[model samples]
Target chain A: MNFIRMKYTKWFNISKDGLSKNNPIMIAVLGICSALAITNQVENALAMGAGVTFVIVGSSAVISIIRNFIPARLRMVTYMVVISSFVILVQMFLEAYFPFIFAALGPYLGLIITNCIVMGRAEAFASKNPIRYTLVDGLANGLGYTYVLVLISIVREALAFGTILNIRVMPEAWTDWVVMAIAPGGFFVLGAIIWIFRELTNNYENA
Target chain B: MKDYLKMVIFVLILGVTTATVLTGMDALTRERIEENQLIVLQDAILEASGITDYDDTISTFEANLEVIEAEGKTFYIDGEGRVSYTFEGLGVWGPIFGVITLEADFETIAWITVIDQEETPGLGGVVEERTYLDNYVGTSMYPELRVSRTADADDINEVDAIAGGTRTSERFEAMLNEAYQAHRDVWLTLQESAGDA
Candidate 1:
């Protein structure tokens, strides 16, 4: 796969579409609940980002492989089952290997089952695409969500706790902002970031 | 109809496959997960008793901490006569588990470590924090330990509670007092036996 001319490739296009044009957060407006809940801390954001990425890749691959045999009436049900299975695998692995993160994530770990982005990809892309394309799409979308979350968390954690990844970056006299550690603070930061992202990308939706 | 049959078969296969995979994963990881939990509890106990930087947690814990069971109660005795015991009780959302180490007097706290808790982060979750638990140090659990917003600064028995987590503070107060009372009886008996001997 010589890729000096990578911009012309189908995989590149799918990835570009996912990472920028149809981002899970800035463009698609998907998976906001988790984005808000976990972005207060950089560590939680990273853990959640990794977890969601894994779930998305796992479920998308499974759904794409079985897309042909899936009954029309069972489409939603199939997605639910596949997604939940992957979520449970994530829970078990984290509890076993990273118990600290497992405890930190709390209810949000189980709530991955309800994330719309995973199901959205399954229905829109995986069901219609081959596994090769599905994998790229999943990776691109997962990274897209993750980078945005990390960005938001950097801002929130710095302001909320005067630290970045638990390292004290702010001066000793810095007063912590309680709002940034709570849900409403997440809303404000996420909204601002989304607006700035849209401005930079020129993604405007007119009524 | 054939479509209905297809649906049923697809569901059955998916269910069985998911079940099999999860069961296999659980079988593989269950031991490690259980071990990880035990390691946390053990480490907390060791750290509470001022033990750290050991080669292996389990071995060092066994070598250092002596466990005694009396009246169906278990207590870990450190070399320095400090006593540590596991405590479990309800927090606001779920259970809180920790090890509380008391000084030789059995009244003043040596150290306290929250091994596991399910309180809300940045609020009730501060119960597990080192800074918050540090407040327990030198505080007497004699009579009862009070967690209050207006903690009497001079009173060692009263410590400042989490500012935004009143319910959690109240629950924590009750939980600690209950655990103290539960373990105090066995501790008293051991003290008397040692005095006589």
Candidate 2:
């Protein structure tokens, strides 16, 4: 019974670490490019989040399963190929079923191959962990990344376009802050989020 | 030697598996993707022709469209006599595709829609925005359309460009001009033929 409880606790901690303690975007600062670029609209943010989640989860699972077979020196290249294949699959699926979101994402969807969070998890966690743990870790990290993106997008879209998911949330009199719809806006929002999170956690030593 | 051989075989197997998976996915989605492209094109054409209530049935709208194949390209003539031409050009990153509709006079633009582009999001990608596209409506295509950073209300052929997307705006302008010039004579001839009939 104690052994089982410890196993469960380990799983919970891994998920907790991904969610807040070692959050991919806020804490580790991985995959900031897409976070900034796609957060202007809530829909784009959601679609990006979904795409990243799919890629990360798929890649982590595959990498974990094939970890033993990967040559140590050639591991990075193998990881890239696996990640890109999944990315392509996501891209094709989006193009066929969700063309609007696919078009909106444009080249950013293809750039998911370079998102460090996917690679980082594969290298640090998935390669050493069992299959189930790797899958859970991928899910946890992807969700963490997604939540941050959605939060930023809500602020950006409300301020920039006076809308959320293209629906007008702000009053007609509310003038748009054009900067909030661009890269600088993303940087400002992300910075403030990180600052607040760090302050609340009192984790300045890491920075 | 054994380890090296194993590594090579593993990589070879992975490559083959990836290729097979992608090929299968491509085959599965090819038809639907092509169909979606058609719908997007049709919708853009309808929007350009000033038809805002396009959600009902595309087939009904398509029924009134006369497709002309000339100069190895397709041009659409709606029931209202508006002519639409699809054009493609290089954006900063990839091809920018759009459909532009002209009034029967072939001089005044009815509307324009950027159907596809691979521009960087938020910057060059502003070309896809309705606000940016709205600037082309009622603009004259005579002489040539000029994308100006500054608003020139007096210049009928000039439209305001996206603030941060100057290069993309310029490329879009060039694309419109080239496409118009290429199809101008053929479109006019078709109009004349229709009039004669």
Candidate 3:
């Protein structure tokens, strides 16, 4: 079991250097811009998470399948083409079925193409990995993003509405901190979350 | 050179596929989307006008209303009944639009619906929620309705503004007042007609 597991982990599992030591959105903090902009509402955050998950998975799979064929000089362009196509598809589908969320999310859905997390995963992990491992990386990164987004939305919604996800979880007498619904509030909460995650996962280096 | 041509062909193929799929979906969904919107509008008119069970078969109230533009804004009214005009204004950074159905007297506000707004979701967007919009239900003004700071239901001049969204409240007041003034001149004619009758 050790021999087989180590062999698998060696290529697929994030390296110790990549783990808690270089957490993508926290320590390394590649996609913090979007983290701040789209964390104001639970609805937008959920839509964003879905869009990112779709784009990341699609891009990862596409990149892995074509990795051997892509010329080194043309690799970035190829990834961009693949990623942007998925982003447009997600945007169109959301507009069709969930126009309200699409309108709320506005231009941010299209911006997923530029989110460093997508390109970073493709370049850093998917390009070198097999299909199975490429998927693992995509799933891990998507979950990582969803975790942060949900955390931020919880704090923002609770403070703004005196509720969590529209449920009146707070006491009647509690005063909502109004600023928490703003973008600046998202930044502070997200920073604190990244810091806490870093401290908790500190033992695993880059776990 | 050949590789570049192949890449170009691939991009063209993908682009065409996406455009065709999205356009086809848009066409199929357009009618349903319009039907859904008409349904909401019908519901709103029925709810606000305080008329119910008049006709279940009706889908949309053909707004016989006309838009009269003046002073960089638009006011709407129809000949049959009193003028019920919608006003669009800015609440904080987003848009706030409402329906104010004037009574036959034209000065009193019979019904007001904050039809749509794009203020902060949980806080300011509460304009759509019952607690805030309900304040305007059955609301009337002898001269001009005023907004209160707290729950001053007794205050003749004020309505209790949403606690955290004071800016939105202030904007609504200003816009409503502007709308009231704009409609005042036309309202005089309706009053004159009532007097003659």
Q: Which candidate is the best by TM-score?
A: 2
**Could you tell me the lDDT of residue A156 within candidate 2?**
99
Every candidate's DockQ is: 0.76, 0.73, 0.13
What Cα-based lDDT does every candidate model obtain?
0.92, 0.90, 0.72
- Per-model tally of clashing residue pairs: 0, 0, 11
Weakest ten-residue segment in model 1 chain B by summed lDDT:
B147-156
Instruction: Give the winner by TM-score: 2 or 3.
Output: 2
Q: What is the lDDT of candidate 3?
A: 0.72
Question: Model 2: per-residue lDDT, tens digit, A22-65?
Answer: 99998999999999999999999999999999898999999999
Write model 1 residue lDDT over A69-134, tens digit each, in one string: 999889999999999999999999999999988988888999999999999999999999999999
Cα lDDT tens digits, model 3, A1-207, are: 676677566444554334444656776787787777887777778778878988888899988987877766677887887898788778767766776787778878899999999999899988998988787667767766766787788888888778775688889998988788777898889878887887787633433
Tell me which of candidates 1 and 2 scores higher on lDDT.
1
Which RMSD values do the candidates have, in order? 3.9, 4.0, 7.8
Can you tell me the DockQ of model 1?
Answer: 0.76
Question: Which model scores highest in DockQ?
Answer: 1
| Model 2, residue B59: C-alpha shift (Å) | 1.7
